[model samples]
Every structure is written in C-alpha cells, then in structure tokens.
Target chain A: MPTLRLLAILQTDCPTCRLITPYLNKLAANATPIAAVSQDSEKDTSEFVRQMEVRFPIQRDPGFALSKRLEVVTVPTLYVLDENDRIVRQEPGFDKTALNEIATLLGLAPVATPYDGAPASKPGCTSRHLEVQTEDAAAAALDLHSPRGAKASSIQLADSDDPYEYCYRAFGDALPVVPPTAERVEKMLRAAARDPQEVIARIPPCYGEATVEKIAANAVMAGCVPEMMRVLIPLARAVADERFNAHGVQATTHFAAPLIIVNGPVRRELHFNSRQNLFSNTARSNSTLGRALQLILLNLGGARPDAIDMSALGNPGKFSYCIAENEEENPWEPLHVEHGLARDQSAVSLFASEAPHGVSEHNARTARGVLKSISYALATVWSYRACMGYEATVVLGPEHVHSIHHDGFSKQNVREFLFENTGVPLRCYSGDDPGEGFAQRGLYKEITIDGEPCYQKFRAPEAIKIVVAGGTAGKFSAVLGSWASGPRGSQMVTYPI
Target chain B: MPTTLVNPMNERAPQAAPAAPRLATLQGKTVALLDISKPGGSVFLDRVELLLKQRYGVTSVIREMKPTFAKPAPAGVIEKIRGADAVIEALAD
Candidate 1:
C-alpha cells in the first residue's frame, strides 16, 4: 500500500476543503494516508466532517504552522508525497485536474474513477462553490451504490404496534407513554455530553443502573425530544441524590415522590408552561418534561405498580409532576434564585411531595383573610402517621399573588401566617373512624406534651416552603405537604445541567 | 390450529354454596390493632377491639394507634404485632 501525506487548512467558510474531505476519505480507503489538520481550520470544520460520516486518518493542529512549513497557501492543496518523503508533484488545488496528468508526469496510467462509466478527468475542484454540488452528487452516488436490505424482524420489550399503550400496560404505568425507539432514543442521547455507558446513578432496591443511554431511552419513551433531555437529566440526578431517599420513597407506603421545579433561561427557552394551565397537560414542554421524569422512574428505576413501589391510589403526578418557577411573576426572587442560585442561571430542584391540594381564596378581600384560609388548609393534617414531621409548599398562582401582594403580603409572611394558624386542634383528628391511619400511628400524641396536645402549634417556620407558580388565571393556590418522609425527611436538592 | 368445543348432553352447571350455618375460625383469637394516626385511628381500633371481644373470645386485646398519619409507622408497631398471634390493620378514614 502507498502512503499519501495530505494537509488541509480551513477558514470559517471554506468550500474546496469541504468538497475534498469525502474524496480524501475514499482515496484513503483505497490507499494508506496521513491527513493532518492545520491550526487554521474553521471553527466547525472537524464537526462538519464528523457529521458527514467521513472516516479516515486525520489530525488537527490548533495553529497553521504545519501548513506554513509545507508552504501551501492555496487550499484544497493536493500533494502526492511518496513514502520516501519525495513529492511526486505539488498541485495547488484540484480543478477538473487528473490522476492522468499527474500519472503521465509520474510514468503511470491514469487512475480510474472507481465508478462505472467514469472519465479520465473528473471535474474542476478549483471552484470552492462546486463542493456542495459535487458532495451532494457523491452522496447520492453512494446511496445508489450501497447495498439495500430489509429491516430485521425482531420483537423487543419496548417495541409494539401500539408502543405507548403496550409499554404502559406492561409496566403497569399510571400514565401512557410514547414508546421509545432506537432512533428516538439516539436523538435524546445527542442532548448530553456524557457518554452513553456512563452510569449517572443506581436506582434503589432493584439497584438498576441508570446510564446516560438508559435515561435517554426512558426520556424517549416518555415522549421527550432531544431538547427535553437537558431538563430530564438534571431532574434524574436530583432525585438520585442519596439524601432524596429514593429507596424509602419507593419502598414505603407513602405516596410521595419527586417534584421538579425548573429555574433559569431554559424555562423560557423551552417554553415551559408557567402561565395559564401551567401544571396541566396543555403544553409540550410541560407534559414531556414531566413525562421524561416518569419514564426514567418506570424504565430505569423499576418503580412499577404492584411491584417495588407500593403506592396505593398513586396520584396522577406520578406519571409526571414538574413546573417552571414563574420567575417573572414572583414577588420576591424565584425559588432557585432564593436558594443562592443566579436569577438567570438554569437549574432543577427536587422536593419529595404528594399531590397538591388547591386552596381557593376567591372571595378573600384582604391578604390577611386569604392567609387565614391558606393557614387553615395548611394545618389540616389528615395523615397522622407522618412522624418524620411535616413540611408544606405553597404554589401561588398569579391572581393569588396579586391579591396577596396588593395587601402588602410577602411570601415569607404567607409562610409565617400558615405556620402560625393552619393546624387544627388534636380533637378534630381524634375519632372512631377506622380510616384515620395517621392518628392511629400516634403522630398527634408525639406532638403532645405536659398533658396538652400541641398539634396546633407550628413545628417550624422553615417547614413551609413557598413557591410561586401556575397560570395567571385564578386566585387559587395549592398547598402540597410532604408525605411521612420517614427518617430521611424531604430535602430540596438542586443540580445544574 | 382449530378451536375445540365440547358439548355435554347433561349440561350440568357448577352450583353455589348452600345456605348453611358456617363457623368462623377467627373467633376467640387475640388480635392487635395498629394505625398511623391517633384519634381517628383509635376510634377505628376501638370498634375493632370491641368486635374482637364480642364476636370472638378476644378477652385481652392490646391496641395501639400512631399519633400522625404523615409519618411512617414506627418500630414499636411492628414489635407489638410480632408478639400478638394475629394482627389486623384497622384502616379508618
């Protein structure tokens, strides 16, 4: 085999170099060659070549010193340097120029075009504009020349005529999913810089490995596009945080799971529905972003029904529960910004929680009255078995925000008001009804001291985290309290993607 | 493959249980009632406790109801069940 030394120097928009790369690849395949990239290469030249599926011996130089040493100013520079380091001839660039012209000079027959009905002279490579034309032509030629074959008939677990419905039934999924195919999964893979095989975290109990590829597959199954993976990856990492206690969440009868909150420019960029119908399935990002998390839970973590996760009457949010912080409407700072993150930076925060209970305050004329209603709802502890203590989150809608802010109420003020007034007296929960599992667990009794029940007392002001979200439509906000978080009480974890 | 079907000339069908008096084996057995809440759970447990004593020879039934439903069940509940011969979770609303 003969070794040909080739060097290509590029500009931001080089034509001849683009046209010759594929030809060089073909030439390299027929003969041994060394392709050294010059430092003066275009910003995306290497990437462009990679996308074109050109595979050949190549090197890149950050500086064009090599090109200068070769004294090759004109590009698409073709030099047929033999193994002995002797230049047979130096062609400034190819332009309908030939192997025959060089072959005649080197005493060899003109090289054939490797294609049928080919001419001795190909085409002028001098015209930089001819690259795209010939490149498309060559691509079409390759497509025609390549062998045609039928797809293999193989039944895969994730494959079905009705992939979404089938996978949902197979996994006993709470919500339907978009079946993940190899092509779609591969698309999701493009969102991350991480290697497909790199293990991000291990799912609890089942100890299933969650690799970048696996998460991407689940994201695809969850109907996530490549762009959605940016949000999904961070949400997965947040829940996988050891402090999140995914193991206990799945194993315990508590119907609590991860609640995703996004903060950053990505919210607007991804068009997260933080406006009207924010939490509803009204927008693509809203549904798919949340669905991506669910898919990861089902396929990667194996949190299937009647299986590892024993959630009785599992809430619909289990399918996907995520919302972007209404940074624009928040009276103070956004949730992420309040947590010491930059206002403009993007991040994902996970909180262990149950389904949200709406606190409607449509008639409240003043902030105090509205706070009283919210406080009443916040104190209603129906789940007395929760001994790990209690933490509440207030997701304020825009209408509610205006009413409260107009009355000079801050989010902290709302939290304090809820902390001070929300709980009911112990007697309200004490009863003969058999379904009161929380009181039967002695949670109220634990809060009692000195012969007086302290159930009405606020455990801590910090127990309540107030976040503003939802659409601007109604004066209704939701009060979502944590399930019995057990030993590992709910913790908010934030991760940057 | 052809589907197969059988037709019986007699056409006898399965019969339901007869209306006879049947004795319940759960009678006279001591049961433990535990829950995750206090007042509401104890109310349910009280009814369960009364039922156990009246219908069965459960003269001495120990009952424990948790204080809060929001927290996970404590270790004591499991330990109490371990000592009892049988346990019934008194789930009350």
Candidate 2:
C-alpha cells in the first residue's frame, strides 16, 4: 500500500468542496495524482465524484474521522504530505493564493475557481467534524486526529432502546451523563498531550489504575469537552497523590469533596469564571471540570454516595467544586505560586474541603475589619473546636481584596490576623466552663495552655489560606474549612497543569 | 442518534483484606477507645468505656482523641493505641 503524497480534504455537503472538485480533477489529469479525501459517506462521495465527471479515486472518510486528524476545521482543506507522511504544505479553507500555491506545488497551472472572474476569492463553510450545538461548547478544538476503532471496554447496548441505560445502572452519578462513547472519549484523549495508557495514579477504594484513557472517558461522561482534559488530568493526579489521601477523603463520613483552585495561564485559556457566580454554575470550565473529578471518584475511586461516601449532610460541592484564583487582580501570591510553582506556570490546588460557607461582610471598611469578619466564620469550622489543626480557605472578593490591598496587607498578614482573632476562649475547651461535656469525648485539652482565656485559632499561618476570587461588585468573602486536615486526614495537593 | 460509550470504571474485583481475628474475651486486658474529631463521638466512646470496664472485666483502659475529627488519626496516635489488647473506634455527628 503506497502512501499518497498529495491529499485534498473535502466534504460533499460543502459547496466550496463541490466548486473545487473540477479543479482537483484538472490537477489529477495533469499526472499529479492528487487524492481527494471526502469527509462524507461513501454513497454521497461517489455521487459527488460521478456528477463532477472526475475519474480520480475519492477516498471515503465516513463521519469525517480522518479529517479530524488533519486539523480540518473547514472543508476544502488541503495537505501535501511527504512520502514519509509529514505535512510539507497545508492549506486550510478556500483562499485563492493557497489554491494557486498548491497548484504550483503539484506542477500544474494556477487553478481557476468558479469565482475567479468575479471576486477572485471565497470563504468556506465549517467542517463537519467541528459542529458545536450548545452554549457550553467552550472547549477548544483538539488538534489531533482520533484513531479508528480504538476502544476496548465499550458496552454496546444493542437491544436497549434507551440511550441513558448506563446512567441508571450504577455508571451514572445519580445524574444524566453525556454518554462516553468511544468516539467522544477518543476525542477527549486526543486533547491531552499525555499518552492514553500513561497511568496517572491508582484511584482509591477500588484502587483502579487511572490511565489517561480511563480518566478521559469519565471526563466525557461528566459533560467535559475534549479540551478540559488539560485541567482534569492534573486535577486527577493531585487528588490521586497519597499525600492528598484520596482514599481517606472517600471513606470518611464528613462533608468532604475535592475543591480545585486553578491558577496561572490555564485558567484564562480554559475561561474559568473567577468573578460573579464563581461558586455557582456559570462557566463550563468550573462546572464540568469538578464534576469530571467527581465522576472519576465514582467510576474509578469507588466513592459512590449513600455507600462508601457517608457524608452526614453532603455538601452541594460534591456535584462539582472548582474555581480559578483571580490571579489577574490578586495583590498577593497566587495559590500555585505560594505552593512552589512559578508565577507564570499553570497549576491546580486541591483541598479536601466541605462546601463553602459565605461570609457576608458588607460594612467592613478596613483590612483589619475584613479579617475580623472572616475570623468569625473561621471559628465555626468543624464544630467550633472538635476539629483542631484543620485548614480553611478565606476567599476574598475583589471588593474586599481592594480594601485589604489598599491597607498594605499581604496574605501572611491576613493569615496572622485571622489566626489570632478566630479561636474560642479557654473556657469552651473545659467541661465545666459552659456545659463542658464536650471536653470528655476527646477534644484537645492541651490546644490552649495560657494563663488567661487567649486561645489559638489555626495550627499555623499556613492553615489559614487566603484566596482572592468572586465578583468585584460584592463586598462578600467566603470560608471553606478543611476536612480532617493534617496527617489524620487528606492534606492539600497542588500540581502544575 | 444513540451514543455508545465505553465503561470508565475499573471492573477488576477489589482485593478484599482479610478480617482480623476476633478476641475471645476481654478479661484482664487493656482496651483503647478512639474518638474521631466529631462532636458526639466522644460521648459515645465514654459510654463504651464504662461497659468495657463494668461488664468485660478489662484491667486497664486507654482513651485517645484525634486533634481533628474531619480526618484520620495521626500515626503517632495510632501507634500509641496499636498495643492495646482490644480497640473500638467511635464515630458520631
């Protein structure tokens, strides 16, 4: 089987593809042997070639499968591959100069088009492979071709008429999934630069090997488009880290979930919403990304709710909890930068956290006042004293950030202030102090050992992490406390994206 | 048109850990009660401590509480209680 050197990709549904069919025939007639790749069914392509009176062999690309690999976003795309299959000269769309250049490359006369005497140029229609139908179709186009028949574990429900059968039979996370078909999952895998068989980590409970291909299938079911694999792959790796203790996070009955905070260039590249509705369902990156991780937990990690995941009052974030740090406007170091990544490097910070509890502090005018408003919220983390040495995230909105930044407060300054201002009085630690029966069960009595009632809030300045996100209009902040922080539970893990 | 998706889950059967051998009796043995960081977990463990002392004839008892309830206990705490003849982990809201 000799590999063809010159290839012209087309679709029968495109008028430009039809207009250029004769020009392609003329080139083939000149002994150049230019192969026209049709992105249509065999019947439609044969009909097109028959109608055009062209004798050239038209190769069939059913479902535009091969066209997707050539990065053919529009029809009438052309590629001049070398004998070694390297694309030496490629032209996208129907530009006159590009067509003439191709004609020169094939040693043919400058090809004339249907509009050569009129406008001398024309625009081409969209390619069949890149059709986006929904508003949430914000993921970027994968720049590689999907392999044909590359699936191994796909379950074909041939007799079942219902397409959503997988959703009900334990594969679904109590929500309808987008059905991770082989074609869609292949597209998802193509988005990542990593190998599909590259094992990211061992998912817990089930301890399944999470290969790039396995995670891609879950990302597809979670409604993530192909490009989201950029964010999801690293996000999956962070949680799968044993230091993050994904197994403990899943087995615990606490209201814990993976809260992902994006940083650096990938946040903007993926269009994550760090402004209004930052915690709400506003952006496809925010919603589907966290959901993809959760789906991985269900499918690979085996942390299904009402089973291994025994949250007493499960937070809504279990559905999806991802956000980007407003790195553009942040006055302090971004989460990733503080965690040893370069300032410009893209990374994800993972925390085993409960759902966010909003801190509505509308009246604070000073930086100290803002910290004070947040300190009270920090005091309520994990039952006011039962869970000590835990962590919490204070998400400051743009308005609060402006105030804090104006007051010359760094992240360390805020953490110190919150740590000092947040703890309960020593009286609460003892049983006799205020209906002190709680001290008997195993509360840390040595946590506060001062002569007076001065108690310490967080274990260290590091535990009170400050992240800037949310809308600029609101003066609100939020507190997302840790879920059994320290070695006793899952610690935070951040990875460069 | 209907979509055909591949299974993302790991179908391999999870290797189950063998169960610990049951203790025959609690007579003259030290039993440790572990309290996770939640609120009512300690009260539950306190009651269990009384039952072990009164009914089981345990000679000694050690009670340890995690610094925080939201996570697993630290290794140091676990190591301290690992030597006990019997152990009971209590969990509550």
Candidate 3:
C-alpha cells in the first residue's frame, strides 16, 4: 500500500508561517503525516518551535538544499506528495478555501474556520534561497566573502507592486526613498570594502546594531552614491562614541540633531557643496550623505520621530544637515586640520546642534565689526540668560572669513575675541525671571564689557568652534547652539574616513 | 513574480526576562529611592522615601542618584541599588 505525506516549507521570520502554525497543528493532530522543513538555523528553529507551540516534526534545511531542489519561492508553501514521491498538489501562502480543500482531500474536517481570526488569505515571505543578486560589473566588483556574507534578511515584494510606495509606507522618514534593492545594496557594500556583517555601532536608545549591510541599505534608500560609504562608515562610529552621547541627543526635548561636518580631499573629490548654498540642497553628496545618516538613525537606531525621538520643534536640519568646509576660501586651517589631522586626510566631525541662526554682517568691513555682530548672536545661544554648559559652532561665510583674515585676525584671535565680548548684559536678568540666578551659580564669571557688567557666554574660548563655509558672496554667517556639553552631555567627535 | 530587497533594520531577538517577584509586604524591608538626576526627581524620591519608611514600615531607605537622566543608570549605581529589597525610580521632567 502506497502512503501519502504533506510537506511544508517555511522560515521562522515569515509571518505567514507563524499564522499557519495552528492549521498545521490541526493536520498533525488528525494523524495526516506532516513533515515541516525550516530554512533557519537550529537555534532559531528551536525557538520558533517553542514560541509557536508547534506540534509537528520540523527538520532544518541547512543550506536550503531541499528548498532549492523543490524550487520553493515562498515560505509556508505546501506540497502534497504521492506514494511515488510525485507532487500531487501545491499551495503557496495562506488561502482559507485552499486549506479547506486540502483538509477534505485528506479525509479530515476543515482545518481553518471563519472564526479562527486568521486572515482569509495572506502572501508569504520570499524563500531565503531566492534572494536577488545583480549580475553586472558592479556586482562583480563586490567581494563575495564580504557582501554576500551580509546578515540582513530579505523581503519580497510582488513584481507588480509599486516599490517606491511600499518602501515609503514601510521604511520611510516621512519622505519617498529609493527602494533599497539587493543590487543597489550590493553595489554600496562594494564601496565600503568592509565585512558587510561587521557591526559598526549600536545606536541608542533602542541600541540597534548598525551593521555595514544595514547602513548600505539605508544609504541606498537615501539615494547616496556608492562613494559616500567612505564617509558614512566613520560617521556611524563617531555618533556611537560615548562622548557624542547620541542617546541624549536623540531623546532630549531640546532641538538637537547630529550635524555632519566634512573636511579635506574627500569633500572636493565628492563635489560636496562648500561654497554656494553651503547648507542647502545644492550638492548631491551633501544632501544624500546627510539624509543617509538620518535614515540610519531612524531605521537602525529606532529613533522614530513619533516615538523615541522626543525633540520638540525639531530642526529642519534633521532632514539633512551636512556641509564641507570651504578650504580654498578659508584663511585659517580647515576644520579637520585644526582637529589635528593632516591637511590631505579626509575626516568627518559629528556635533549635536540646533538649527543654524543666521547673522547678516554684510556691512561689516573690519574683523572687529563682524566679530561684534556675531557676539550679539552668540549671546542668544541656548538662551540670553542661560550661560555655560552649552557650546556653539560658528559657521562663518567666506566673505566674512576674508574680511577677518585680511584684518590680521587669526582663528585663535577670533575665538578669544568672541569669548571675551559675547555676554548677556547683567541688566537683562530680571529679578522675577526664572533664569535670573544663573549668573550667581558660580558657573559663569562676571566680566565688564563696554564698561557694563555682563555674564560671559562661554566658559572657555575652546567652546567656540569656527568653520568657514557658504558662498563667497554672502555676508551671512550662522551659529548652531549645542544641546548639552562636556562629560555628562554630547561632545564633538571627529573620525578619519 | 516577486522582487527582493534587503532588510534595513537591525534584527533583534529580544529574550524576555521575567520581572522580579513582588514582595508580599514592606515590613522590615529596605527600599531604595533612585533619583535619575533630573530636576525635581530628588524631591519626588524624598517623598517616596518618607512614605516607604513611615507608612509601609520599611526599616531602612537607601537614597541613590543616577549621574544623568539622559542615559541608563551606570552598572555601579545598579549594583548599589541591588542590595535593597525594592527600588522606586523617580523620573521627573
């Protein structure tokens, strides 16, 4: 007498697989001779069995040998084999009607009911063996040992579905993103030249592992070119550094986001916008690279805008805040060079800052005139009365830099002059104001500026970070205030690319 | 016909740890008040400590503070609080 058996191919991560567990258990209870194959590691398979309360025997399909032989394209696929091992019936995904028909064919009662709470029908996840790969030169350029070894799981979308809409609905940052197709991700991994499975950082507050493959997927979604990986890989490390305090930056109610400042040869090599429209969407590298990091933080770090990210009145820079220093127009050493890196070495600096506060000093011909105007704006950082504990990045326009440079004022001189002159007048602190007593807290020193008693804005000149950027024609400079500074708060971090 | 894409998210298989068993009674127990270093957190914990000692009959109260509210309590702080029978953490805006 020939016997019959039901074969089920599934993966632990597939939602349909878990959904169909009860039906499979029902078949098993009926003595229908069911054999389930799991395309997952033994550890995961065992966990799945325990969690789903699986009743049937499940054999692990190492290397997906059986799945490939059976040409399985989706999980929760069912095959009814005859006594001769010939397939009599095949079912993909979950269909209530199809399940009932199979139950009837097996001489058993209906497996699923309308009251089962399961959907009438649902598509299954793509079989892991069917993951797509590119066949172009870009794919050939990838190191098979690295990118193919990437550990990120795969998701399958129907060929007719709109990938853009699907990606936006599922994985977007409130914006349409390029679908991170496997081909595009592989191309990005090629540029990284690192193990795609390597964990770059664990982003807070969820502390998700920012693996190289995951970063590449985010980069693809942000529409970044392959070359941008050079900067992004290091930028990830910088943000994860304890001194950067990403948890504080992401969770604080204050308006703060990680600002990426690029310097050195890579800036020019990537055509990063350092001159005209420095902070705007003028350069692809500037726009996409900045956007990539934001996506990484959102997707991998789990800093969803409506969830863990509690920033009130979030800065527009959160969309994309990246700029390269205008090295040619800068009078002092570039930001990277100032940070102890050689002039030719490329590096990325991460700073937790609020939106840029623009200062129009168009008429200031002399360095002192420009510095004085900037000091007034600098005093307003954090709050006019709030002093110490905060830092600011002074992004000077090239025109302003030229004016200061021509006046024989070095970068150190500019920092010291700003520190000495930038202060809140003692009279501004009204007795009834809540922040009035900050000056007496011993956190700030009272200095006489213009013969008026004032509370100094910064504890030290080093608190002011200056970088020359923006169009050579514009007289507008900007100040980005820090969230919180020092050991307890976020500190600026620089990493070589 | 289906198109495939890599998952951009970090796959986390979080093992659910069981919560600590509830104490039957606070009598003769030592309660730890943890202030997360946020403003007003200490004031809230102070009241909690008083209530635990006076009303709940907690024999002793251990007052501890996290270095900052922005991150989790350091391991040293957690170890210090582990000696207490129960801990009440104050989170103040």
10 residues in a row with least lDDT, candidate 3 chain A: A138-147
**Order of candidate numbers by TM-score, starting with the best:** 3, 2, 1
Candidates in order have lDDT scores of: 0.60, 0.75, 0.84
Task: Candidate 3: give its CA RMSD in angstroms.
Answer: 19.4
Give, for candidate 1 chain A, the lowest lDDT window spanning 10 residues: A140-149
The better-scoring model by DockQ among 2 and 3 is 3
* Candidate 1 structure quality by residue, lDDT tens digits, A1-497: 46445444433234445444454555555544536453333545565555334566455544455565676556656666777877766665443345335444444444433221121222222223222232222221111111111121223542224655655555555666555566666677777766765555555534355666777766666666688767766676577665566665665566686778888899888888777767688878877877777666665566666776777767777767887888788887778776777788898877778888888888987878877778767765435323226677788887888888898877777777766665544555555753443433454333433354545434577677878887777788888877544344546667765
How many steric clashes between backbone atoms does each model show? 63, 9, 0
Give the C-alpha interface root-mean-square deviation per candidate: 18.3, 3.2, 1.4
* Predicted candidate 3 versus true structure: per-residue lDDT over A131-177, tens digit per residue: 55434221111111111223899989987889998887777568889
Per-residue lDDT of A181 in model 2: 78
Off by over 4 Å in 2: A1-152, A385-388, A426-453, B1-3, B17-93
Q: Chain B in candidate 1 has what TM-score?
A: 0.58
Give the CAPRI class of candidate 1. incorrect
